[model samples]
Target: MIPPGPKAEKLAEEARTRMLNEVDERRDPHTNATVGQLLDRYMKTLDVGRSTHGMYAKYLEKHVRPFVGRLKAGALDGETLDSLYAELRRCRIHCTDRRGVDHRTPRPDECDERCRSHVCMGLSSTTIRHIHFILRGVYEKGVRWRWVARNPVFDVDAPRAAKPDPRPPTAAEAVRIVDAAWEDPDWACSYGSR
Candidate 1:
């Protein structure tokens, strides 16, 4: 068999060196990917219901992405996660509520009396808990991927939501309400109720 020429030999040697460098780069301990990288991988691996995946993506973008998306996965400690959680709560409280028939934006002063009473226009505990849950799930995924040492959510306590009061109407109150409803001329007369 004829021997390879000098030009061919030089090209082959260069290609081999490039491949070895790539392998070494992949093996290097110092070249770890970032949290964002892992999140992308996690998103791809998700086999959840479509609605759930959409919800997760929304929370990730709104709450987690801006703060720690670029951070090294292994470097995100409990403190950082805790701070992010707090910020999310704050954001939810201050978020603008623009939905209504008139489409008019209500000023803080025009908000319901309850909303105007707090230092930081407060959110319901349930909403705060939901934000916490989202963060907890993301961190749990990090743990599974060996990115975080542990899920910080385990250490932090989620806000306690108040139970809805059970206030069934009394017999007398129910009778009064039904009578008033029957007396309403608009519907009652239309329905032939005297």
Candidate 2:
């Protein structure tokens, strides 16, 4: 007793899709797995050096775990991943030095303190990209296991790497370097001869 029209067709489609998803979830062993659980399992199987393993653990706990740990694996999507990267780009942390001392203020002459932590502490693009890499690996595993339909990280735009400082050598400096090379007899015998 249903009227056939565009509205009815749309309703029928939605019902069919919902039922399909429900069935899929029922069959999926990881449908109930949280993001944190997935990451924990993935991390366990990952092979890395002692230092690198520590670094990965730190980043996972600080960034990804805080935001998406509780989210169901199947619920994740591209837009969700996009916002996570955007959050990482503008992330700020308390500027600190190797000794764990706060150095919030920078030297008046220096432009910025990326390597040295100060009040303007923030994660670099390289660091953000690294974090993304770890997540991508875990999500790909999820896809292969049929825990999720797709990897959301694939839909996200890549992080923008910071440009390196351009320091072209002066012509005078270049000439002095060449003059020094010619002055050395040992250099001429081994390298300059070729």
Candidate 3:
């Protein structure tokens, strides 16, 4: 019988090691699976529009991944989620705004002030409610996959979002507004004599 060459032996060994590693990873109870993994699974199951998937991926990468990427799939809990929310609020305030030209770094203290007094402080209740919804969905998937026994999000109460004041314009109001605009000389000039 011919002896196996070193190259052949190395290939065989690599194949065997890869197979074993895959099995081991699958069985590893404490293996870290980040929000990215959950997001992929969610995208597969969700019947939402592509826009929603894009939005969720953006939020997962920007807000969720940095804090929870190293945490084991089973290690997330209510307290951990709460802490993550706090961190997100803090980060939003301190986040660099490069809206205009000449990307200057705003003062660190100014950033903190903006975060605490405005950005963090003024976060709409609707935004907080949406965060709660995302967390609930993520943890629910964890439960479904047997990574978690129960959703931590189920145990917490999110603040109620303020209802938008319903202001459907009446037919008369609409007509009045339209008529006023049509009669205005400035409006006619701006709208090309329409």
Instruction: Judging by TM-score against the true structure, name the best candidate.
Output: 2
What's each prediction's TM-score? 0.52, 0.66, 0.54
Collision pairs in model 3: 93-115
lDDT per residue as tens, model 1, 149-171: 55667777787877999999999
Evaluate residue 80 in candidate 1 and report its C-alpha lDDT on the 0 to 100 scale: 78
| Steric clash pairs (candidate 2) | 95-118, 104-119
- How many backbone clashes does every candidate have? 0, 2, 1
Residues 93-190 of candidate 2 have per-residue lDDT tens digits of 42223344334454544434634423334678889889888888998898887777678788776688778999877999988888888788899578
Worst 10 residues of 2 by lDDT: 94-103
Model 3, C-alpha of 156: deviation from truth (Å): 2.1
- lDDT of predicted model 2: 0.76
Off by over 4 Å in 1: 1-31, 93-123, 173-194
Position 1, candidate 2: lDDT: 36
Residue runs of model 3 more than 4 Å from their true location after superposition: 1-32, 93-123, 163-194
Tens digit of lDDT per residue, candidate 3, span 1-194?
A: 22478688777878878868966766333436755576567667877789987776676666677777667656777788777776655555435543322223554333433242223343456665676787689778776775555577776677576988999889999988878877988886887654
Assess each prediction's global lDDT (C-alpha) against the native. Answer: 0.68, 0.76, 0.66
TM-score for candidate 2? 0.66
